[model samples]
Target: MRAGSFGQLTQDKENTTQVTFHYVEGNTETFTIPIPASEFQEEVLQLLNQPWLTFHLVDQTVFICTARLIKVEIKPAIPELQGQGIFSNSMRVSTMQRAAAGRLPMNT
Candidate 1:
């Protein structure tokens, strides 16, 4: 079977979350499949049986590998820590102070 990508989302009802899967590509296509929370593992197994590139949820978006049998990196949707509003100024100040302190040896 040819490897392809799929997307999944989780929803909650009665304090339990359900997972849903959607086929991203194929000839016999299914737009989506809603799976109960209790059946999550089984659903994942079923998808993997097709050897599909599963897109996992990270923060707000889903990320799927570009190819099967290949380790593809998925960059996070969020900005880098240094670029984040909470850390940017502090990071810059710390970096400048460290530079002024001079470059120390690799090990302590």
Candidate 2:
């Protein structure tokens, strides 16, 4: 139920592995699997090595696409703030936030 950007991802030692998938069309899905804490890396590696990611849900299994490509079709990009000065960052942030908030001028 999120819009605009690929949503957040939070991981910690106390929880199982979780991954969120975002599509080119703006759809998203998340899958969480309770796995042995010691096998976290192994599990992730196994999944990433496969062609697609599998989700073993309660009722059924879901397969998500995982093809990798060098180029992606992206909409107008929000400039990433790097090591710029504070004022420059602030202005870019304002512009990006406004665009994300759907406040762009009609001509744009």
Per-prediction TM-score to the true structure, in the order listed: 0.21, 0.43
Query: What is the model-wide C-alpha lDDT for candidate 1?
Result: 0.35
Collision count for each candidate, in order? 0, 0
Q: Please list the residue runs of candidate 1 whose C-alpha ends up more than 4 Å from where it truly belongs after superposition.
A: 1-33, 53-108
Worst 10 residues of 1 by lDDT: 70-79
For residues 21-72, write the lDDT of model 1, one tens digit per residue: 3333521211222333344433443444554444434443443333332221
Error of 2 at 54 (Å): 1.6
Write candidate 2's Cα lDDT for 54-95 as tens digits. 677889998876664222221212233224341332323576
| Candidate of highest lDDT | 2
- lDDT score at residue 60, model 1, on the 0-100 scale: 39
